[model samples]
Target: MLNQIPLEHILLLSAVLFSLGILAVITKRHAVVVLMGIELIFNAANLNLVAFSRHDPQLMQGQLFSLFVIIIAAAEAAVALAIVLRVYQHFNTANLNQIVTSED
Candidate 1:
């Protein structure tokens, strides 16, 4: 039943998600929120990759690529969160703007 859906629909959904992620990353000032936005962007790509993979019965390339992307995103998130944590400890704030202005 899933294969009956047109690729356009999936692509459209991915586009919207990707756009929202861009907006969040651009507007948010909090470290964690910006990280969430980055994750959203990753998820949007993953969705498109898996969706395209589903279109082919024998081709698993897209799925494999998405898995690699997922692993990379996980590692990026962990490292970013750790950096954010250290920033918070040193600056006593999670707000990006505040952290920037307070730096002497």
Candidate 2:
């Protein structure tokens, strides 16, 4: 079923998602929302990797790389969430702008 659809369309969708992720990361001030934007960007890359790998069945390089990316992203999210929790405990706010003003 996927073979019928052109690769260009898949790539175009990934590109659009990547653009929106960038916008969210840039415009949003909340820490968790920014983290979600980062996840979106990672997912966009994962989509491209799977799309490209679909043509080559012998070597699943793209799929393997995408799996590694997913693992790393999970670990990153866990550590970042821990840090955000600590920051919130100290500053009493999760907003990025407020985090910058805290002296100690």
Q: Rate the local accuracy (lDDT) of all candidates.
A: 0.94, 0.93
**What is the C-alpha lDDT profile of model 2 across 5-96, one tens digit per residue?**
68999999999989989999999999999999999999999999999998898989999999999999999999999998998898999999
Task: List where candidate 1 sits over 4 angstroms from the true fold.
Answer: 1-3
Q: Against the correct fold, how does model 2 do in TM-score?
A: 0.92
Model 2: which ten-residue window has the lowest total lDDT?
1-10
Q: Say what the RMSD of model 1 is.
A: 1.4
- Score every model by TM-score: 0.92, 0.92
Candidate 1: residue pairs that collide = none
